[model samples]
Target: MERARFDNLPLEWIRAFEAAARTGSFTAAAQETGVTQSAISQRIDKLEKQLGTHLFLRQARSIALTVEGETWLPHVQTAFESLRQSSEGLFGAARSRLTISASSSIIDLWILPRLARLTEDIGAQLSLRTMVLAAGAAQEDDTIRIRYGAGDWPVAYKVPLYNEMIAPVAAPELLASASDWKELPRIALSGPRPGWNEWSARHGTPTTPLPALRFDTFVSALAAARAGHGVLLASLPLCAGDLAGGKLLRVCEESLSCHQSYWLLASNEAVSRRQWNRLETILKDPVPREGA
Candidate 1:
């Protein structure tokens, strides 16, 4: 059997077929596509002829997909979805919704606090979406992406938000009269940052393992520390509020420069210059420092 050439199939016919399959009626498909019922029937017929297979089993009151049509439906639907997303990316969507995607930890610890100010500054409504950064995940081109890295995203307008500084922090109650803070249970972060081992080496703390509870994100570890569970190695920017309120205190004078920093990234067409500038300004404004 000869395979159909790509150019031989028209997009209009495919649209008609999809609408008919989805709506289950040629009349309804014609209404959706703004064509006559006969026109829709003709297009589906032409599509079936091009594919050398019958797609629909026509009935008195409705239509159902043939075995071949059922097999082909998902592929056709996926292709249409891809095309729609691509169109939205290129021309922008009709809605004024601005989406910002970032890691769950970043959103909770950093962005959420400043989100109201951001919306006020830009005078536009914004939506926040959390994304987990994993290898081989598709990058979202249609929304602003806040990522933690060395600030080298190709073909993107990039701005460094802030470099992270990490320090050992604990609830004030946890540190009460505790002479050897190192011996206390440590809440450890298991993610990308330099964690307990590096902090210990920097602060000259003993390398011996202590009672430890591990969390996949710094946010969770910080929460555990805030609840007086254990000492946490936490980022200063994210926990600045807790430190200032005396909810958490630095265990030692030692701090480590996280080399990795959070960066704001967007395609050139993703956001207007004015919108991007306002968002950057809002994010970069300094928060009240600990004890100040």
Candidate 2:
């Protein structure tokens, strides 16, 4: 029997395989491809037969990609992206309108500062949609979304916003007034970033002071900290530009390297392979803060 040529693998079969591998479920792949689960499974089976290797480890409730599947996934995604780039180059327009759904704090702190550069670099009309739910933008169906996590968003291209580095921050006046930065009134945030208790535990400080003020939103807490209300356990990456410009002062030398981070869930349509390199630079690399 002759080995099957790579190009002979049907695009639909490849799509089924890619979707199943990425989502880690035949049902999800079916939903994404607008087909039934049986069809997804059948296509994958055909592809596996063609390749003479199993792509997924079948389990009771979940599926794990075989090493071959894991290795081939990126290549498939890249090929699709290349095809998109060529099509876009020949037939697509000069600029596009893209809406980003995320929490208001991320819009205000991280993405907004680079708005001008981001739009210009990517050639898109950028629109910001502030997510109202406590879940943030994770549940949104917008063209782009940002989520906070350990960055395992396999279904979409994960554009890393930042690794969370948190430290206590305060306005200069508050720091000057208080002799011990640790004893200053603590401002608390309600979400994922670690608060005073975690900070204290990590630093081995026995007494964890109660927060003088608490807010459900990071932006509000940050505003309070900036207004000299209290010292905030700040996400350093989110406010790196501000720290660089002396708008906020890091109270201590120590910072906790929380394993989680904010990720921009980008698809090829959200940011094309052609534009992604430059777009990533605009997002990940530091830019000049506007309206300083």
Candidate 3:
């Protein structure tokens, strides 16, 4: 009955193994770690050798955890999460910074504009981190996350930022063309959320296929629309500034409510009343009028 030695375990090897297990792919784990796939495989191999167990059942197209790996995964994840929380508590207090995670489009279009007001009100420096929703990024407990989806995330307090509404928008110049605007090339966003098909259904527009220009993010799609490349289906709150500034023009009066909405999600540890109040005030404030 010899006691197990903890000193021999390498943190990096465990990290590599955990990432690979969580993502179910060595390639994905490598991408997350900013390492080569071969390096990830090597690290996992080393970890398995050290532990004397086969952690993964490798297949041609996928990888599955062996029973040992499945049991080990939670412990590894919990360890990492604890480390993150401890580091944030130690370092974040010194900097007096609050970190927030949101999609690039949301940050660029909505949050960035109002950030100064938030900082001014909260008396703390704010750090913005882009959470690429398209990439399946996990939310960290150390930060507040502005995520778009149905409000059902467990272990986090969810606050409705806004009810999602989408409408067609284009540069004013697009209206000059003799062609019907509906027939104009449409910009499409490809992601978890619905796009033109859903918009059409909601607005009673015919579902006939139109010439499309696809972009992976709403930011890019909106940029293309502003450049007069095509009409874009834009989230109302995200585009409020553009519309107000006349950078973009609503193509029609019709707006469609989406099943999904932007939510402010914070883990229990992160959701202090003061911090919540700061965010609530920032979002609840009415957009300033022109020249006001």
Candidate 4:
């Protein structure tokens, strides 16, 4: 038996056939794909004629895939699904010039202040978007995503950005007046990272609830700490400015080494773009030695 050439098969016809096969009814497939049942039937008919094999057997109100169609259904379904995902993803990326998705805290405390230097030095147009950590999230269209995680990204090449450190911090006045560590107010910030609990555990101090003020991002938590509300569990580099300016003070002599590091993850297709390259440079820059 002669086999039909794969290139000769119209994509539309294959899609219609797959839909009809999956749904077991042309009317249902038409409803799913938003095309007339007649159009669906016509395409399948054309495909059958092209392949010189009957793809479906008609019944009273529904149809069943012939042996040939049954054998072809899985491959066609997989191909169409891959095509759909690629088209949607690439098209979305092409619409945006440059978008960077990062943790809200990093954007607020670290990246936002340093944005001007990058813009001036790199001399490129760019935009930043922020998001909280959630599993399997698309940060933005064709955007470079700076993620804080252990260095294993299932997709995309992961570049090590930097390791993070956390310590208990508060306003200078609050620390100066504070007599006992137990009496001090502890501010919980952002997600459950290396915070007061970790600090308490390390020093074998009893975990006491200190009139907690909770925040979803480090920026707000740092602001609250600066306002003299309470001591905050802050990322050292992120809170470096406030710490230097005397807006925030380190309450704990000990710090936690967060094994989780920051990473730069970009879509495979978007890696060669100029905007992505500039962002990569800033991410990989050497850490400055305490106000150097």
Candidate 5:
């Protein structure tokens, strides 16, 4: 008997036939797929027509597999299992424990907010380590590192967290005070991130406000900004949550885009191909959308 070309066969029909065959009930197949029993019946009927063979022996109160169906069942089941394994291996996070290291500020401002979704996407529980400095996250093996740079790491895999954008941002209340944002005391931090001088130069602004308060890290600088002490030239990616949640407000509509970005870097042994693919999908769009 002629058979339908495999490529032409509808996967949904195959799924209906497989589920009905496995459970010995059309009702059960419908329950599994959230469709009506008649829908499953229609699919299998169409499937039989395409294959030119009956797959079930229908009875008054039940059904049994035909000889052809019994012969074809194991092959279909094997194909389903193979598809499952391929999907899980390529897109599902591994069940192994995962270790990740990044700066305290990235962990606090960026990673922490998206972490629940991150873990879910990778399909593993995470062991997080806060890197004390930029150099700290690099000096490790069997750990995935989040680093900010031009993506020059000599690692097996590296993907950017998001494009880094900087601009003046302040507490909503501070901006609402009707104070000149440029005249408000600025908050400064030590990092490779572009600051007031770069902002002034890039956007054709004349004045570069000096910081009245300074800190060595973004966590401190942002805290001061949130408290309404001053405006901060902030990393938009890092403070994305705050801006979305109304904890902070953009001082201007413009953003100073940067050439560098935070990166997820990992050595070969640090992740499976499946896990890495999952990580890329999750981290590339790390920030949650508004009202989400």
Candidate 6:
């Protein structure tokens, strides 16, 4: 006997054939699969040609499975169902291993100090990665991403984390010694967003540009601030610890909202996990009071 020819049988046609057989109507199957009834019929007809067997007995009002279809239906349905279940299982497991990617400033100033408290074992190892916001959007594989922006995204789940509120901060000695705001040297905290001009506008200070010492990272900027190097326009949360510790002081009470916010994003695959739930729980916790 000649071995059965599988070459003529297409996976798409098999899928269509399976759906039509399972639903007992071409019209119903087409609706489920988002295709036209005639398309489903054509697929089934092609499948039948490939197999040299009639799979359905068509009637004006309804359809009934022929002997061959009755035989093939269970196997096809079982295979597809098993594939779907396995895929879900694998995806769920992958999602549990959380890798959070964000701007370096956020990781250094906000997330690093607080991670020890999320001690629960959720069968996932938490990891952090940094990417440049100015470069482009997060890749499709990134699990949890915190970005600074207005949060307009297409085809994604996005949540506003915090507004980029900023104010001038410096070591206690630097503020005590500077004659006025105009006398201080400007300092650059490494990140894409800028706050100096915005601060000047909000505080009614003159827009005379000051020469800034550039630091490659927020942590470096914080270090310089702590050492009384210059005036640093820093994110509130990023400098929260230093301010609380008395290492750094806010230069002025007034702060300018940068209009950009930190947003939490997840790919569809990463959103469904219990680990993501736990991460969100950690993120949503209120920042401790300045002195607390």
lDDT of 3 by residue, 1-292 (tens): 1235345688889999989988889999999999999999999888887777899999998999999999989999999988876666455443256788888887887777777777677666788888754566565887888877888888535777777788889898986673566877788888766678887877778665574689877888889999999888888888888888999988889888777887888775665555666677676554832222
lDDT of each: 0.81, 0.80, 0.79, 0.74, 0.84, 0.73
Q: TM-scores for all candidates? A: 0.64, 0.69, 0.62, 0.60, 0.64, 0.63
Off by over 4 Å in 6: 1-36, 39-94, 119-122, 132-138, 190-192, 271-273, 288-292
lDDT of each residue in 1-292, candidate 1, tens digit only: 3654446588999999999999889999999999999999999998888788999999898799999999999999999988865665566433356789987887887787787677666656688887875789887777888888888788446887787898889999999957888877888787778877787677778755664688887778888999999988888888987898999999888889977888889875667655666677777665722211
Task: Please provide, for model 2 over 75-144, each residue's C-alpha lDDT reduced to its tens digit, 9 standing for 90 to 100.
Answer: 9999988886688656665436777878889889888788877776777777888867753435443367
Which segments of model 1 are wrong by more than 4 Å? Answer: 1-95, 288-292
Worst 10 residues of 5 by lDDT: 283-292
Q: Taking the candidates one at a time, how many backbone clashes does each contain? A: 0, 0, 0, 0, 0, 0
lDDT of 4 by residue, 1-292 (tens): 3553555678789889988999999999899999999999999999888887899999997798889989989988788867766665455343234566788776776566667656655454567787666687654536667777887876544676666888888888888776875578888865747766677888776678654688887778878889988877778878788878888878768788888867888875544334445566665654422211
User: Candidate 4: where is the Cα deviation over 4 Å?
Assistant: 1-96, 132-136, 139-141, 273-277, 286-292
Name the weakest run of 10 consecutive residues (lDDT summed) in model 1: 283-292
- 76-149: candidate 6 lDDT, tens digit per residue: 98988777655654665544467778867778776766566444433566788886645555376556788777
Candidate 5: tens digits of C-alpha lDDT, residues 69-90: 9999999999998887576566
Candidate 3 lDDT (Cα, 0 to 1):
0.79
Best by lDDT: 5
Model 4: worst 10 consecutive residues (lDDT sum): 283-292
Ranking by lDDT: 5, 1, 2, 3, 4, 6
Q: Against the true structure, whose TM-score is highest?
A: 2
State candidate 3's TM-score: 0.62
**Winner of 2 and 6 under TM-score:** 2
How far off is residue 5 in model 2, in Å? 8.6
